[model samples]
Each structure stands twice: as C-alpha cells, then as structure tokens.
Target: MTSPTRILILEDDDGLRTSLRLVLEDEGYAVFEASDAEKALLTVEDPGVDLMLVDLMLGGMDGFSFIARARPRTEAPIVVVSARDRTEDIVAALEAGADDYVTKPFSVEEVQARLRALLRRPTIGDAETEDADDDVLTLDSRTPLLFDAGAAVLRRGEEEVHLTQTEFRLLSVLAEHAGKVLTRTALLQHVWDQDYFGDERIVDVHVRRLRKKLEVDSANPQILVTVRGLGYRLDTA
Candidate 1:
C-alpha cells in the first residue's frame, strides 16, 4: 500500500502550530511539526516529507533564510504561512523558492484546500500520459508532459531544462493544461498552491523565467504563450 502524504509545518507559536497539526492530521495528512528553522532543516532531511508549510517569522533563522537553505535539500512543495502580507514579502518569498504563501488569520479550511491542491500537482520528471509506448511523446520517458502523473524533467529539445523546483512546478502546471486558457487565479491556485490574494506579477515572473529555459525567444514565446487577459497556456500541439 502507498504511504500517506507527509507534510512539515515549521511555526514557532505553540497554539497555532498545534492547531495546524490537528487540522492537517484530521484532513488525512501525516503532519510533522518544527518550531524553528534548525528543527525544520532536520525534518527536511528525512526525505519522507511531501510538502512543507513555513512561517515567515520564526524564533530564529527567518523563513527567507530557511527557504534559501532548505530549497536545495528537498523537492517537496514549500508554502510560506506568515503575518507578512505585503507585496514585497510575497514576492521575496516566491523569489526565495517558496511555491506559495498564506497570510496570518487564514482559515484552516483554506490551508487544507491549498495543501490538497499542491499535492495534486504533478512532480518534476513525471510523465503526463500513461501510455507505455515510447512513441507517444518525444521527451524523456520519465517526464512526457509537464505535469504527467509520473515524474517530469523539463527539457528544451535534446537539452534538459534545469529549473528550480518552483519553476518546474509552474511549467508543469502550464504543460498539463496545454492549449487550454488558464487564468492567473487558476495558475495561482495550482502552481503557487495558494489563493489569488497575492500579486499576479509573481506568475508573470515565473512564466518569464520558464520561457527563458524552454523557449528559444523568451520575449516572443511560442511554447508558453500569453493569452492576453485570460493568462497563459502551453502550445503542446
């Protein structure tokens, strides 16, 4: 049988941390708790964690620093949960390798929803399709489409597209819904694993970054095309 998904919660407040643990555990997730960045790093080393929830303000080693250090250690999705709701904070978190951010006073239901959505997103180096035939796609057998249920490895023709985990997740989402118009809200929900409360420019930056790796011309992108006000889409065809 498959093991339950494990989630790491790094928060300093005892009450809030316990509350989140209870709420997430009740939602059928295997939740792990850490009160500071040091413990959080230890938890990340376990390799069992499937996702992470981090507080921007911690007792020591703030979220930004934790993110910078932890990003290289794990491929799991990281969501920043904090009282810092400023646009700069959000952007900085994203820039620092956070897949998403949630403000303080957030509902447990919202957290649960975001966690589920992020877990549903396809991992990197996974194939989008289930066909055993290799001819169905030309990309690596490991990652046939950007968001295939299997694993996905970003590629540009014969070259492998080396992307940060956040960038890989963003590209995977777009490639999964290829040819379909995905609104900024939808992208935020799926790729960033959060509500659409933050600036949409976050998506724009990541998309530009992704295009730079996948497209020959990032300015005039062909694969990752903008759909005007509708947001973006991948031209798989």
Candidate 2:
C-alpha cells in the first residue's frame, strides 16, 4: 500500500489548527502539525512532506521569513493560509515562495479544494508536456524563457527568473497558447484544476506577477498584453 501524502500545517492558532488537521485527516491525508515557524522548520526535513499549509501570523519566526527559509529547504508546494486579505500580503507571500493562499473564514471544503488544486499542479522540473519541444518558451530573440525541467527554474538568457509554482503553471499555459487570448475562466480551469474556488482576480494577480518577471517592461509589456474585455495573450513582438 502506498503511504499517505503528508501535509504540514504551521499555524499559531490552536483551535483553527486542530480544526484543519481533523478535516484533512478525515480526507485520508497524513498531517503533521506545528505551532510556529521554528517548529515548522523541522517538518520540512522529512522526505515525506508532500505539502505545507502555513499562516503568516506565525509566532516565532513569522510566516514570511519561514517561507523564505523553508522554500530553499523543500521543493514541496507551500500554501499560505491566513485571515489577512490585503493584496500586498497575498503578493508578498507569493513572492516569498508560497504556491497559493486561502483567506480566513474559508470552509473546510475550500481548504480541501485548494489543497487538491495545488497538488494537481505540476511538480518541480516537470515540463509542460511530455515529449514536447515547447518547454522552452522564448520571445523577440532578445530574451528567452528557458525552463530547466530538471531544476524547475525559468530562466531568461543565463539569469534565473525565480517563480512560484503558481507562476510557473500560469506561464506554462500561456506558452502552450501563445499569441492566443485565454480568458480568465480558461486559465483558472487549466492552471488551478477543476475544483479551485477562486475568481478572475486570482488569474489577474498571477499574470501581473508573471509579467514582472517574464517581460522586459511590465508597465507596457511587449510580450503579454491585455485585450480589452477579452483576455490576456502573449505575443513576442
């Protein structure tokens, strides 16, 4: 029999933490719990750690710092779970290496769905498609997007443009349909999988994040452009 997928929950709130653990355990996932960043550090060393659910308000080290440190140690996807809904908080956590987030007041169903969505995302070093030459996406011959399937780094020329797992997945979709406008609904379905309970804003934030890293000029992007009332399309020109 295969061992259960392990999920580590790092949160300071006892009640919510327990509640999350119970719900996940009921779903047949083996869960490891920690009260703060310091404790969470130890769980990452375990090879069985399949994913992590973290809170930004963690007591000792705080979630942001934890994300920075833990990310380097583990390639497992990290999902930030917190009550903070500020766009800045969401963006910062993503920049800090979180694969996704869930605001507080979310249902256990939402948590389960997000976990499923994150897990469904391609693992590190996974090319967008098997036996496909489309892995390396480039534009303008000036800057090229190189995806090292073994390392999972999206590179421009020789420089590595670090991306969260979510960003990588989003870029992969855009690359597959380059020069074609994919609506927010299409993107959310392809990138987040079928069970994600998120809106177009999620798509928008990730695309903006991708532009900053993947484009030469994020303000007036040369590659990724928004079609008024339509969607986003990537054109090298």
| Cα lDDT of model 1 by residue, 1-237, tens digit | 878899999999999999999988887889899998998899899755899999989877999999989988887888889999988888888777787778888998778877777777655545543331222132322333233324445444545556776686676566666679899888877775555455576787677767776666568776788988789988764
Question: Which 10-residue window in model 2 sums to the lowest lDDT?
Answer: 127-136
The residue-by-residue lDDT of candidate 2 on 163-228, one tens digit each, is 766777777777778789999888888888875667566787778888898777789887778998
Model 1 Cα RMSD, Å?
5.0
Off by over 4 Å in 2: 125-128, 133-137, 141-143, 146-153, 158-162
lDDT of 2 at 16: 94
Model 2, residue 20: C-alpha shift (Å): 1.7
Q: List the residue pairs that clash in candidate 2.
A: 125-149
Using lDDT, give the best candidate's number.
Answer: 2
TM-score of each: 0.75, 0.83
